[model samples]
Target: MMLPTDPAQNLAKLIRCPSVTPAEGGALAVLEDMLKPLGFAVARPTFSEAGTPDIENLYARRAGDGPHLMFAGHTDVVPVGDEAAWKHPPFAAEIANGEMYGRGAVDMKGGIACFVAALARHVEETGGPSGSVSLLITGDEEGPAINGTAKLLQWASARGEAWDACLLGEPTNPERLGDMVKVGRRGSLSATLTVLGRQGHAAYPHLADNPVRGLMTLVDALLDPPFDAGTERFQPTNLEVTSIDVGNPATNVIAARASAAFNVRFNDTWTVESLQAEIHNRLDTASRRRKYRKDRKEPVEFELAWRDNPSHVFLTHDDKLIGTLARSVEAVTGMHPALSTSGGTSDARYIKDYCPVVEFGLVGQTMHMVDERVQLADLETLTQIYRRFIGDWFGSR
Candidate 1:
């Protein structure tokens, strides 16, 4: 039996599967085939929610007596926008100028591929590590996250599965392979704000209230007086207004309603509940301001609806896990990696509840771009880094 020791070969097979969001696209099947040959016991579980599409997830365990290590990632890729614009077919896994072109190549099917190759090489050369290892992969990361990592973690915990540490294979580097390793992530919270008013002719200003004016006031309140000064270990919280909509097509009429959607990437300064309270307070105070409605005497009538569950902030404190992975990266790439917490939220937010988790993978300069590609050299370097981390982590334990 041949081992899947080559990172490029493993990645090509994965990229060929068009496993776009909510679609298996044969990606999980291919992964199962690769893991089975390495003596892993794999189980494919399908999870469902009311409005979300049923998603398939994989949990494969190669058991041993020592502390368990979990490798987590997703096989799904975002849809290719304008497939004709790609230099190479998105699913063809074409190689040109030493870089492989495909969807999910760097964000992040490539990460999964290198980790699998590292494990394969370890099994072939050293009969594997002394500890157990498992891969918790989900197909729903790129889609509605309702049935993805959060629920998967609960299901696994129900079955008595536990881990000492986790290394999530998310693309963490900004410019080069060893540029950064993510040790923490800011929280994410999203909400929609709607202001209600009466519609009337634009010329009849006194007969109707313009909700757009009120919306501007509320949005200004949210943006001003920055959330907080920079924290010691985390950046200051920031909020972005993603969309503002009124749905009015007429030029001479005032719309009856105006709404805006906003998301906040917050640090440890506030919890979801406290943040919600602060936002409510800001809106409450702003709604009564007469600056937007000088003639009106009443507060702005508005509704605030929070979208989905909020992702809480987290930071890993495990020295062994962080130090071992950092050393492995520096040893292979000859550059010390920065321990950062600067990117957007990921499935690591969910994994952190179970055990300490850190993220490291390939350089992510081209992830999610029209021509998503990864250098063949980076693949080998990342594989070596992961392989080294695996051996050292288990040996230290």
Candidate 2:
């Protein structure tokens, strides 16, 4: 049997699968074929919730006598914005100017490919590591996330699965390979605030209360008072107002309600509950301010609704895991990687609850762009880095 030892070949096979969110697109099947030949016992479990699309996840374990290590990632890719805008077909895995162009070339599928190739090379040369290894892959990372890593982790743990450490294959490098390894991540919280008012003609300002004014007051409160000064290990908490809507199309009428949605990438200075309380406090105080509505005696009539689950902040303290991966990157790329906690939330937020997790993968410069591509040289370098980390992590354990 031939092993999947070539990173480029493994990546090409995966990119050919158009596994957009909520769609399998044969990506997991391709992965299964690669793992089966390497002595793994693979399980494809589908999870579902009432409002979420059913998700297919893969858990392939190659059991050994030592501590278990997990490689977590998603096979799904974001939709190609404009297929015609790409230099090469998004799913064709065309090679041009020493880079491979495809939808998932860097955001994630490329990371999985490099890791698989690294493991395959390890198996062929050293009969694999002395410890256990597994891949926890999900098809719903780019979707609603209801049936993805969080549920998959719970399901795996229910069946007596555990890990000493995890290396999430997310694109962590900002500029070049080995430039960064994410050791922690800030929390994520999202909510929508709506202000209620009476609708009337815009010219008759005294006859109606403009909810847009109240919404602007609340939004200003959320934006000001900067959540916190920069923390020692993390950046300052920042909130972004994503959308403000009134649902009113008329130009000469005041809308009955105005709502604004915002998301916060917060540091460890606050928990989800505390943050919620703070926001409520801000809105409460701002609602009573007469600056926006001097005509009204009562506070601004408003409601706050939180969206989905809030991702809590986390930082890994496992020295061995961090040191081993850092050394591996430096050894391969000759540049000491920075242990960072910047960037958006990922599945690592869920995995951290189970075991200490760190993220490292290809450079992420071109992820989610029209012509998403990865330098061919990066595939080889990342494979070597992952291979070295695997051997060192298991050997140290």
Candidate 3:
């Protein structure tokens, strides 16, 4: 059988699969088909939880005795919001004007395709690396990540497979290939603050308490003081009031309750517990401030509830891992990629607990856009970088 040497072809096959979040959609099947030919033992496992949908994941390994390296990514792409807005069909894998158009073209699948090609080249040329290479791919990344990498890693660990280092193909480049590599990510936490008050006619101001006023006060307290000065590796913490709701439509009625939802992207200065406590303290102080009016029956009565699993801030300090990827990117693109921690959360957060992980991938100029695509040249260049990094990683260590 002829081996798949062209990364572009690999990516096209992947893009053709409409594997939107939590859907198998044949994306994993295509990946397994490619990996099996390259001597990787591939397995697709399904994990389930009571509330969340069952998730399918892929774990492929080329076993060896040296320092193991893992490549992690997601096969599922975000929804292609509007089909008509795209130049070509979202899943057609059409190449026009030197770029391939598809949903996951750059955000991920392109990066994964390049890594597969690089690995294939290495295996074909050298038979195999001194060390092993494994891939941890999940379908739930674009969903509520409940039963994905978190579960896959535990399964791998149970089978005695742990990695020395990991590389996540998460479209880290902001403008161009090699412009950036994510070394860390800021933590994320969110909460819903509900303020309860008496509902009555707006004309009868004395009979009704306006919760909107109280909710606004709480929001102001949370935003007035900066969380902290920006850290060396992380930007300053930021909180945004994502939503404010009273659900009241009538002009003459005061809302019985008003709620506001806020999310914080915090730096390493605070942990999940400390940050939650700080937010509560701020709310407590603001609600009781008498700043609203002395005639109100009592301070704003509000309740705070923390949402989903909080992502903790983290930094990868492994010199060899960081240096290898940095040099590989520089060698290929002739640009020094900035080691940054300025981005939203990713599966990398879960991978960090098991091994040192970093992210570097194709230019993200089109990720999740109406016509998501990747330049064919960028695909080849990324493959070369991955090949070099693989050689440098196992060759040196």
Q: What would the TM-scores of all predictions be?
A: 0.98, 0.98, 0.98
All models: lDDT?
0.94, 0.94, 0.92
* Clash list (residue pairs), candidate 2: none
lDDT tens digits, residue span 1-397, model 3? 7676789999999999999988989999999999998889999999999989999999999988899999999999999998998999999999999999999998799999999999988888888698899999999998889999999999999999989999999998888888999999999999899999889998997888888888878889999899899888889999999999999989999999999999999999999999998998898888887667467747889999899899999999989999999999999889999999997999999999999999999988888899998999999999999999999989831
RMSD values, in order shown = 1.1, 1.2, 1.2
lDDT score of residue 123 within candidate 1: 96
Clashing pairs in 3: none
CA shift at 259, candidate 2, in angstroms? 0.9
Residue 173 lDDT in candidate 2: 90
The runs of at least 3 residues in candidate 3 whose Cα sits more than 4 Å from the true structure, single-residue gaps closed, are: none
Task: List runs of model 2 lying over 4 Å from the truth.
Answer: none
| Candidate 1 per-residue C-alpha lDDT over 77-166 given as tens digits, one digit per residue, 9 for 90 to 100 | 999999999999999999999999999999899999999999999999899988899999999888888888888889989999999999
